[model samples]
Target: MRIAIDAMGGDFGPRVVIPACIDALTRHPHLSLTLVGQQDEISAYIPSAERQQFADRLTVLHADKVIGNTDKPSHALRQRKQTSMHEALCLVADGHAQACVSAGNTGALMALSRFVLKMLPGIDRPAIITAIPSRKGDSYMLDLGANVDCSAEHLLQFAIMGSVMTQAVAGIAEPKVGLLNVGEEEIKGNEQVKLASRLIKEHGGINYAGFIEGDDICAGKVDVVVCDGFVGNIALKSSEGVARLIGRQLRDGFSGSVFRRLLGWLVKPVLQDIASYIDPARRNGASLLGLQGIVVKSHGGADRQCFGYAIDQAVAEVSMDVPNCINRQLEKSIAIKYRLKRSP
Candidate 1:
């Protein structure tokens, strides 16, 4: 499968994106890339000799324009159809490529994806599903800043999508789903959470595991966490901040004393492994679910390693055929719901 890269989207633009493509190609020999950006800018990033060696696999599509970070999502697409990111999404929508990856403006990416690729059947809104690392493994979080305010039905749909994703990507046979809430009881949380809980419980197809509070996130109590975009985004950022603080404390504690320093040296490798697993940049990208095509969103500030991981994620998503699985499950759900509604 050919993956399209928005070579001009991120802060570093082609400087980071071009090398990421090379890195991905090095790791996965079967993978091919269609780099979208200004020809001159993209070519400058590739070495003459190396480009010749990978000439058969790499192709560049020139997109002279660019969408800035501050560009309004509503107007940017119409204003800049030739922009690198816009053109990359267009490639996926038009079947020029299997998937598109970008580290540009998150809002614009979602808006453009919805406008271009459109939503899948039975899907009201497209959600951003991010894989958050946990002690057991990686857990999926949904609606991460995609739909700020979601109805109970929307949350239910996110649960369905998240469960399907975790199963396909994380290799779980029947992934457990959790609703992010303030307390673990069935009656806890605000009106939205309560209503969502009712809907989730009534929708028996999903593997609903009841309410999951903030502390349960890292504990890996559930495989997928569903919440409105606002709450999900807040929880994601807060967790990132706490991880950084803990890393800093560990660093200071290790360096402050001779005895501590000796012990730290012995355990430094293990601590570093844990820190690397939880680092935001290592897990910064998200998959845009419910679209007609696959689109992965990376952090705007993502460095080379982060971009590389995002490419790996795109590969895995395509290999698993996540969009097709989601579509089939949604069709089954709608059919079941319709039949239940018509019954006496």
Candidate 2:
């Protein structure tokens, strides 16, 4: 499958993204990538030998402009054309590529994706969903800064989409779905949460695990967690902060004292295992669910390996035909009939 990369979107631009594209090509020989960005800069990062070798597999699509971090989403949509980010998504929409990967401004990507690719049948708005590493496993969460204000019906849609995603990507037969709430009790949340709970529970096909507290998210009890963009974004940021804090504290504790340093050397292998388990790089890509085509967002600060994981995510979703899976499941469950036009 061919995946388009917005090589100019991330923090390091082509310096990081171009190398990651080469790495992905090396890993998946069948995979072809088209890097969209300033022609000269993108080409400069690629060595002559590897370029000649993968010439047929790797193509560069020159995009003169780039969407900057400070640009507003609305302005980016209205003004930025033929930009790396916009052109990348257009490749997916135009069927030139199966999926698109970008480490650009999240809001701009969302707006451009919605406008260019449109939304699938029965999906009102596109939701950003990503795997959050947990003790049990990775629990998928949705609406990560996509639609801050959502209705009960939106939450229900997020639930179905998240469930279908986990099943398809994670290969779980019947992934347990949960509604994020202040408390697990039925009486704890706002009106929308209560209504959403009833709707998801009433959907029948989804494995609704009822309301889940914030702590339950990482406890590994539930497979998919559903919430509004406001809540999901906050949870994502907070978790990231906590992950950094844990890593810092662990390093300081292990290396601060002479005795601890000796002990740390003894348990270095164990710490490596723990670090591998909790590494944020392992969970770098966040899928933009509900779009007509697959769009994977990489963190702007992500390195080559982390960005490659985002590309891998897009490849996996393309192989599984995620949009259709979600649509099929939505039709099967027919949760809260949405009066919207279907985009192909």
Candidate 3:
């Protein structure tokens, strides 16, 4: 499979993206990588020896402009053919590559993806979906920062898209779906939440688990959690912050006095394991669900390891044929709802 990388996007740009692409190429012999960025900068970072080793599978496509971190989404759409981000996305849309991976500005990537790849037939808008690690297992969440204000119909659409992807990617037969809200009771939450609940429950394909709270997300009570981007993005950032704080506090506590230092040394392996489990870089990629083609968005501040996870996600999605599976299952669910509504 071939994957395109927006090498000039993100905090480190080519410095981080290039290493991740090289590592992926080395790890997967059958895979080919196309780095889309300025030729000189991209080549400068890669050593000549290693470049020759993988010359057969590695190719760099020069792009003069790059989408800035603060570039407006509207402005990005206007310069479709110029930016590296747009060209990387076009690689997927044009069938030149199996997927496109970028650690670029989230807003610009979303706007460009929807325009270039178009939305699946029945999807109203594209959503950002990622796997959130939890105690019981990993749960899939959607609208991380895509549609801020979603209507009942949009929430229902998100559920269908999330459910289909969860099933295809996670291999869950009927993934349990939950609506994130302040309380789990039917009486709680805004009118939109209540109405969305009813719509999800009525859908024949979705395994609606009713409403779930913020705390329930890490508890892994449901397989898929659905929310608007406004709430989902805040929740995601807050969780990342809390994890860093707790990890720092623990490390500080362990390094205090002689006895504490001795104990810390003995438990270093355990702490390392815990750190690995909670590491954001270990799980950084998010799929722009509902697009016609595969596009994985890496975190804007991602390093080589973090960005590599994004490439892994793209590879997995491509192998699973995620877009085709989602399109079929989504239309099936919509048809089921229509039939039930008309049955009298």
Indicate the residue-level lDDT of 222 in model 3: 96
Candidate 3, residues 1-344, lDDT tens digits: the string is 99999999999999999899888988888889999989999999888887999998899999999999999999899976768999988889899998999998899999999999999988889999998878977899998989999999899989988998899889999999999999988999999989999988887778999999999999989999999999999988888888898789889999879999999999999999988887767789999999999999999999888899999999889989888988998879778978887998
- Per-residue lDDT tens digits for candidate 1, residues 1-70, read 8999999988899899888889899999989999998999899999987699889889999998988888
What global local distance difference test value does model 3 have?
0.91
Residue 329, candidate 1: how far off, in angstroms? 0.4
Model 2 per-residue lDDT tens digits across residues 216-306 = 8899989999999999999989988888888888889989789999998999899888777778788999999998999999999999899
- After superposing all C-alphas onto the true structure, candidate 2 shows an RMSD in angstroms of 3.5
Runs of candidate 1 with Cα error greater than 4 angstroms are none
Ranking by TM-score: 3, 1, 2
Which segments of model 2 are wrong by more than 4 Å? Answer: 335-344
lDDT of 3 at 207: 94
lDDT winner, 1 or 2: 2
After TM-score superposition, the amount by which residue 44's alpha carbon in candidate 3 deviates from its true location, in angstroms, is 1.5
